[model samples]
Target: MKQPNKEIRVLATVTDYTRFFGLPAPAHPLLTLIDLSLCRHLPRVLTPVVQQLYTVSLKRDLKGLMHYGHQSYDFSEGLLVFVGPGQVFAVSESLDTSNVSGWMLVFHPDLLLKYPLGKKIASYGFFSYELHESLHLSAKEESVLDSLLLSMKGEYEQPIDAFSQDVLISQLEVLLNYANRFYHRQFLTRRTAEHDLLSRFETLLAAYFTQDEGPSLPTVQFFADALHVSPAYLSDMLRTLTGQNTQQHIHQRLIEKAKQLLLTTNLSINETAFRLGFEYPQYFTRLFKSKTGVTPAAFRVSAN
Candidate 1:
């Protein structure tokens, strides 16, 4: 058996990843589709490492946890996980791959150059989601994605031509769009959990503002860290469920508090802003106006 490397292996290219997985050379330098079943020497574990390229994988019947950041996800179903460039994650030591079957599609960032997909790729927030937040695809969704991956692989294995890049890029966009749709489905199907998370977020925000003393403002990262999720994942979830991202949610909460203080308390606008954790009263005034269509003082006067 091949022993796992002690140090993190930074896979910089598709070829590097293929070699590490004990597979043959990639047919294309910039892109490749790996059938996980073809690998004979599967490692029992991998140390935390960063892959400096995009990777989208679908795994099934794996008996181990995939760790990303501080969370671990069970890889025992037909789930899809995405890792953008510079993501650090690891596989569990007790990896049981006896029934493992999946496909990994890896493409270098350079391959996206000169394409519209390159500009919009970052909008696919799943690439930065935690492992536990991976997409759990239904059978029909899995079939749709599987076909797209196979199509991309077919193009990847063919002889390179002038139109090869365009065809491959187009296929990739389709795959991403379908993944986006499936993620929305997942969010809607898991409504209970999402709603629970939103409640926790609201409670946390309330506590932060109610505290008598602390930093002037709570950051999006603060909430994400408290909830044990990435900021991108938290924002994306809020956007899908509440029609707003984390920052917007925070602002909305802040405005509600500000309005209450303005109407019920004798504190001046500056005092109210300070109580709501704003360091600058003017900044608070601008934000209040933007969110409520009136300056803080104007609102306070109108209320009185």
Candidate 2:
């Protein structure tokens, strides 16, 4: 029997994007910013979905829904969506191609290493949010972002110097901070939607830790799939409401379970570990020590 050759999907690198749109290669291979106004849309040429480097797109005059995973959402209201590397994205026909405006900032993770932004970026939560969880901006807010985009464009066009990278990085940070603020405001102001999300989030978290039916702990995607939301959306919403993301929320619940076990049982560390879905007792011990600064046995002894 002859085996068929698998087709390799085209992944867009920085250079590929430049060539695709008739723009120059980026000064830094790891990151680039493109002014939407300078480019023309060729919707027919684009793939239904593409795997590429991370892209942060801020757009105006966009209509129709943006699909992230299984969800469909409106982008007509100046929305912001963060697509991580390798995530699939489907581009629809622009409702008014002539009116397309805004900036697209694309960066590889390598661009942020040895910097504080790299370390703290994961803490921001929005990167993990789903497409429908996109931030909707007001006209005034859009103006503020446009101003920052203009400043960034200035940096990109200038000569490369000792200060160029630093300047651009600072601008990127500023933009992200403003986004953080806007997201917080969105969480606070959109009470009906936010509250509904918050309620659903609590229910989902409770179901996971309840341990009533499952033999093992749920993977992040398990809950995400159940909620019809992305893991990032769940994490971001929890962070907004409870000062914790999904992973942290899971850890907290695990700790609570461990506390109850220590107080009520004569089970050994291994026994408790197995009961809590840990495949290895040592793995369980390490997590317990990391969270509580005490090993399971030590905690049991202290409690006794």
Candidate 3:
């Protein structure tokens, strides 16, 4: 018989994950920490998949691209990456598990269901789809994360007690919080590259405004795609250095163009709004007033 297609596998429960990787069952029903070296073979996961569990992994010697929504991270550096529920990625055919050296901590969404981490978990921006870049950790930083992992591992091995869940949850939350802080540090430390991105962003916005055609309003995703960064990452980088996210930057540029048109041209309020690519004149009026503290008409009159 011809070989069947390598289908997408949904690793929903803690057991599902270990079984896929040929490991023994986990200590808990909802969580597991797997040593990659223990895997005798790798699963064929050439297509994208959104797992039901959250995985935070630090591994080296990966032989294939990790796809996040069609984009791939080379993983030449920054071995740490977080994948939350509904985020898509796939291990390619070239994936190397023979010499894999790292630990993966996975937990079902239900693990956090009753704890405060459950509510706070969704708020983590790094876990969002748009922020798919892996975090590069310094030696000290790696040690900090590893220590927390060890704590989780210790609690995981112990007999079930009331404190087991509580201790594990606390350690996991701290781990996530540290990762967040390190991501912020990564954003600031790479000032030169980020500055180039900023320049490109400004140039892109300028070109968009100057062009006489394409009347649709500019969106955050539009600029994000042009810059080749995730929407959340782009916003975080911008906010860190410039104090405003992508939407704010777009709005600021829009107001500048509106001011220029109101003073430099003879277009009516409606025409000016349309020229600036606003679908509705009322929205233009509202946004203009919010930014300028006066309506378009009032601004034009006050200018003269």
Candidate 4:
């Protein structure tokens, strides 16, 4: 049987999630805004788990690690993070759930179709960012995000109209745009930290291919685990700090290694493929050409 796609299981619907947290049902079947203030505290300890839909969470006055996609993020201050479907996440019960305050906006993908955001949403890379890599809202930024959330809640509470979905979705798109800008700001402001991550990233990539038990291996999870972070977090941090993501970074390094072997050594394309862990030479050729605009052998000949 074919393997299932990688996604977190949010087995609960909007109503289920809300009701579990002690809130009323969602106004719509596909979307809802949860006010943490309205719900009674989760008095019992809970295990971490992942959800199945799109979640745009705005948290405030909370401290805890939200474990998602193999990494635990220390949540401090007001922040936002998006979790795509199928990514496993656990909320650490280290802090009192009663102390947690904020709004959690959960919406299924179905809620987004028929809108421009549905098509352009994939371009929003912040959606893939890890919890540690969550967006930190400045006092002013928090207010802006808060206002948007309130508007959404207000819309839901109003009697349903044809204009309601359009208006709410529009607000969501606007909120996302602002988030994009803020992420760029985060990239700029967190230069030192980003640079550190970049350095570690480089070392990690180099070691993957260099050690005897080295380059022939290491899955995304292995690298993430070794780095003490989540794959999504590492990738998100790279995207925020650099223009590329973790997967792209890996491919870049792989291509560079192939280029070196092609030009510096007499390794045939097939030899290079096996050395680089490609079971098929044609696959390597295709990936190489896609990234560099030339076949591996062609590049090797040109270098000669």
Top lDDT: which candidate number?
1
- Identify the superior model by TM-score, candidate 3 or candidate 4: 3
lDDT of each: 0.85, 0.73, 0.81, 0.74
TM-score of each: 0.91, 0.78, 0.87, 0.80
Q: Candidate 1 vs candidate 3: which has greater lDDT?
A: 1
Runs in model 4 lying further than 4 Å from the true structure: 1-10, 40-50, 63-76, 87-94, 97-100, 211-214, 217-222
lDDT of 2 at 39: 60
lDDT of candidate 4 over 248-300, digit per residue (tens): 88888888878877877776788888888887789989999999999997888
lDDT of 3 by residue, 1-304 (tens): 2222346667778888777666879999999998766763756546455588899988866555565665555653447878877666666555556666778998999999889999998666677535346687899999998889988899899998988888899999999999889988988898898899999999999989886653689999999889987787788888888999999999999999899999999999999999989889999999999998999999999999
lDDT order, best first, reads: 1, 3, 4, 2
- C-alpha RMSD between model 1 and the true structure: 2.6
Q: lDDT: which is higher, 1 or 2?
A: 1
- What does candidate 1's lDDT look like per residue over 105-184, in tens digits? 88999999899899899999999887788898998999999889888988988999999989999999999999999999
Cα deviation of 86 in candidate 3 (Å)?
2.2
Candidate 2: list runs displaced more than 4 Å. 1-9, 22-32, 40-43, 48-51, 64-74, 93-96, 108-120, 212-214, 258-269, 285-304
Rank by TM-score, highest first. 1, 3, 4, 2
lDDT per residue for candidate 2 within 16-85, as digits (tens), equals 7666556657877767888776664534223444556677888777665444444455666667777776
lDDT of 3 at 167: 89
